[model samples]
Target: MTVTAEREPAQVATLDPAAIAREASPEALSGTSRTPALLIEHLSKRFVVGRKRKPVTAVHHVSIRIERGEIYGILGANGSGKSTLIRLVSTLLTLDEGRVAVFGHDIEREEMRVKRLINRVSVDAAFFKKLSPWENLVYAARLYGLEAGPAQREAVRILSRLGIKESRMSRPVEQMSRGMQQKVAIARALLTSPALLLLDEPTTGLDPRSKLDVQTFIEELRADHDATIVLTTHDLDEAERLCDRIALLNDGRVVAEGTAAELKTQVVRDHGGAATLENVFMTYTGRSLDEDVEEESDDAE
Candidate 1:
């Protein structure tokens, strides 16, 4: 693979807040180029678990390039480090080694800039349960320094588009179904119109109709808002539908990568497996998606 970026400590230190804001603006996001939306180079992370404190390599020197406007999927079974990689890129966890950049901004050195450019939504999204969906979103908007008037309007619009009715907006989020809460999480993440969105198992646990709605909304975001998405999913069919390219991860390493059709072709020809994602997963990961891999160590960070 090509070196996605060279170390630029000096340049990172000199980036002005105004310039960073400008770079993350909607106008800037409108311009498309060959520059990747995300680049991971030799990224690695390990957690110490157990009474013996043995190290478990959650992510092991994995690298991938996600292009602007592309939906890049990371497909893996449980405990395969998909969430760990996403956490590292979102700065929720510190990496043990390697580098990551979001739209040319170094994640470590230019963290604020990177934060401005990206947003993440995970299955276990946290919210103040007592607050209404609208209130929760407005709070998030205020933190992003958005004016209340426009932010509320945009929040309402996004929530409505996600199938939330105005009547439901004012009710405490704790009363809503898990699927509805997930939609609220998605709407909040989109409030800034981020250039890059990290979605970790976004449609997991949703009813079929709700899942389809979210999936359609994701496609719309990429087509209409010039957003690049990095999605992690165990749903092979969903990955085949949404991802421009996918990386199959196993044991914290990327075992295969290609478009869905490309991967199916390879598995049939090379591995003598059925021309299906299920077989591809079985061939590579050596297990079914529903089978939970027990945590090998006593402590997993």
Candidate 2:
């Protein structure tokens, strides 16, 4: 693997007063007065690959806490372990080290409770190709113990909000465009008002318009449903727009974590010039967000 690092100075920018107040007041966001909706303490995961017997440490000892209704973003390049972190919290993969909890319920000790409180939507969401969006959603609802009548009603409502036409709801999911299918996947995750939602590259492979639609829907979900969201994305603009706080991951460790302005300020202070989140990623990870090691290797050969 090739590694590079850039240094930049941090600059401070003022945030709107309303934005500051909204973040400070939890009740203004999440409706419930409960403990933090999600918390991960020193979570870590590793994988072994290749004939040479190399261990790939996907997630290092990382810690994060999200208050109910906060939209936290994990920003990194591909293979920087964003998806692995999401999988660990969602219980799709066992943690090689550390612990995760949802609403104070230990993920390891109270697996069922943690599972019920969280839902994860990945880029490669699986669906019965032959099944219509309505059918897929209904099946998901049933699995979540939601009744058919209410579930169907919610499916239509949420899908419509996501810009999926009412007529398209009954068509085969496989027949829909990738963007439409992604919307349906999101709708499925929302079928039961999960207190915490994990979205892994929810807007990847989308057209610009579709990307905006998904971003808007995510904001709406948090605003209307009071859902705390944890999403991983390679899109820096998306991260800047949607995240209350962003954690930059490089080589399986959190190299930086803060609000956008704070991180930018760090770059300016440390590196001696104006800085942005893009600069922060470049400085710590030593590669453009648009570039990856595999691509570089291919180009070199």
Model 1 pairs in collision:
50-299
- Every model's TM-score: 0.87, 0.85
Residue range 1-301, candidate 2, lDDT tens digits: 1121221211111112232232222432333444455778888898999997898899999877776557888888778888898988888899888988776678888887677667888987679989998888889988877898898898888888889888887878889988888888998998866767899999977889989999999887666655678988878889989987788888788888877777888887887555777788888788986686466356558
Instruction: For candidate 1, report its TM-score.
Output: 0.87
Task: Write one digit per residue (lDDT tens) for candidate 1, span 1-301.
Answer: 1112222121111112243347643433344334567889999999999999999999999988876667888888888999999999999999799999887778999898888877899977589999998889999988877887888888888889999998998999999998999999998888876777899999987899889999999888766664678999978899988887889899999988888887888888887967998888888888876564233222234
In candidate 2, residue 217 scores what lDDT? 90
Q: Residue 40 deviation, candidate 1, in Å?
A: 0.2
lDDT of 2 at 296: 33
Q: Which stretches of candidate 1 lie over 4 Å from their true place?
A: 1-21, 24-33, 292-301
Q: For model 2, give the 10-residue run with minimal summed lDDT.
A: 7-16
Error of 1 at 260 (Å): 0.4
Misplaced by over 4 Å in model 2 are 1-34, 293-301
| C-alpha lDDT (0 to 100) for residue 211 of candidate 1 | 95
